[model samples]
Target: MIAAKRILRKAQRQLACRKRKIAIEEIMESKGDPTTFYKLVRQQRSSTSMGTEFLTLNGKTAESIEEVTQTWAQYFQQLATPTAESTYDDLHLGKIQDDINLINQICNSSHQDDIPTITKDEIHTAIYKLNNSKAADIFGITAEHFKLAGPSLITALHCVYNRFIKNQKIPESIKRGILTPIYKKGAPDNPGNYRGITVTPVILKTFEHIIRQRHQIILEETQSRLQTGFTKGTSPLVSARPTYRVHNRI
Candidate 1:
């Protein structure tokens, strides 16, 4: 009877494992359904907990919730802290000063018309381009909020953005963002194993979108064709094709 029970338990475990494999295979085989694949992957994870409960810092394990939170905060704060700028020799420093003076002269000589003002249409286009269902920033505002906002809000944004450009200033609140630590493979307690993903306010993102759209053509023109990374219409393959041809000729 004991042997029979052991055999039955083994069969049941095997059956469960087969079912899991079949489910994953089905999810993978389904075309154009990344959502289902990600759902299945998430479900398979042992823990989806975002809590820093198991975190360790400075050779000490954090015990309480507050301590864990503080540890995470300290870790991220250290990462965000700017490093000291490298000192340049007198000759290099003088050359940098000359470049700065030239830039200042150019800016002073340029007309106000050179800087384009923000328009309501640009704001509308930016809002439409924003992706929905994203995590909110420190202000608890998401892309969906901007998308669903009325025309009056667009006009208001246009006014505010124009003011920002005119005065060359932006609100500190807009600069603030929320950092979420996502775990990468490693010891769960190690802070270095996680990468911080920053979410900024939707308004700021909208403004940036408009700026990028306005300057994209000029920026793309200025960039070299060799710059495949982060550039549109060019990828690793596009860069490699030339090298492959050269190798073939050789």
Candidate 2:
């Protein structure tokens, strides 16, 4: 019995040594590339916290992986789908005749000439601006991949965007998103504790960036001076500075 226990302890020690060697090798490789280091760290953190094994559904615990996945699907479906009894009442304002007229005038105004076609420079700018460490969408393409791709790839993407703009339609691939549920501050077992964050394709984001550029011009022309948030070169701090000065004067 003593001999057998000694052999088991020796095997356990050998296994632990092997694991430590592998971990050391990974760390050494990651040190050469900061991006790889960040990715490895993120994966390690996600593996520990993100698990579907302990999910609760309909007052019962899911036993299998498939059951847990299905439960999450059902939960999201129910949350997205509106109940038959759900209704919205028409909103009425008693004294907003001029406000309504101004809104109608702005909505009816034509601004076709302001819209610009997608250009290679814009695509390149957008690609470089994309975050490298973000999770990829369902297509398994990351922004870092695009950033490394040569100018030819940017040109190709520009052409694709122009084609999409000409058709006045976005492809289904662009519209598709992967929903990842992130746990908030609550019980781990409860589905309500999690919030779904949609990860969109990097290519779609490039197109959005081009569109935003055109929209920004129109917004600058039409948007009220009081509205500073989400505009270029203006933030909440910039908007609050004038208000702070006024308050101090009073």
Candidate 3:
């Protein structure tokens, strides 16, 4: 009777495992549908409990949910806030004189050529090229919002970009960003295990895209051959060929 009972328990466990496998298979099959995929993921997560309820705070374990929440808040606040002892003068601006001089030379040279004006077509292209899946900024503006706004929004953005360029100023709206903490591989409760990523407005991204296009054109003409990373029509493999040949000869 005991052996029969054990067999029945083993069969029940196998049936449960089979059901879970089928559910996972269904989720994999529905990957094309993002909504369904995310829903399944949420359901899966809800079924499991995170083992970490307490967090280490200042060498002490936070026992309650309130304590954990407070500890996290304090951790983030301290991480974000600058130290009182640190001063701007302590940065030693003179150390970067050579870099500053080189940047000034580049700027002066670039200015000698006529500055490219922002266009509606460029703005439209930048907006349309933006990925819809990207996170929204503080204002909750996404690429999809701009795409739906159509030609009127594109024209307005073009005007704004040109105006900012002429005035030599950036708008406060563009300057502000939403910082989100992404968990990296480490202890779940450790604040150091997370990295903050800033999400800027899509409109600012569009403007940046236009500027980047112009900057790339200038870089292609003036950039050194030794600086190959992030350059178009070139790869690290192509850059390494010269070094590889030199090593072979040696």
- Tell how far residue 189 is off in model 3, in angstroms: 1.8
lDDT per residue (tens digit) for residues 20-59 in model 2: 3454356457767867754644453354533544578789
The best candidate by lDDT is 1
Tell me the whole-model lDDT of each prediction, alpha carbons only.
0.74, 0.71, 0.70
- Could you estimate the TM-score for every candidate? 0.69, 0.65, 0.62
- Give candidates' CA RMSD values in order: 8.7, 9.3, 9.2
Which regions of candidate 2 deviate over 4 angstroms?
1-50, 84-115, 235-250
Superposition TM-score, candidate 2 onto the true structure: 0.65
Worst 10 residues of 1 by lDDT: 43-52
lDDT (Cα, tens digit) per residue for candidate 3, span 1-250: 9999989866764565455456566667778986685455445434252323456768877857688667767877887796655456645655666678998888666642256678888898888878765555678787789999988888788788888877666888678886544344456556676555566788788888888887888898899988778878877777788989999999
- Clashing pairs in model 3, backbone N/Cα/C closer than 3 A: none
Q: Pick the candidate with the highest TM-score.
A: 1
Instruction: For residues 1-250, write the lDDT of model 1, one tens digit per residue.
Output: 9999989866764565455456545645653675564354444432443344457888988857788778989988888795545774768778988999999999778766678888888899999998765565678787878877789789899889999888777899789886666554456578997666667788899999998998887877797878888887768778798889999999
Give the Å shift of residue 201 in candidate 2.
Answer: 0.8
Against the true structure, candidate 3 has what lDDT?
0.70
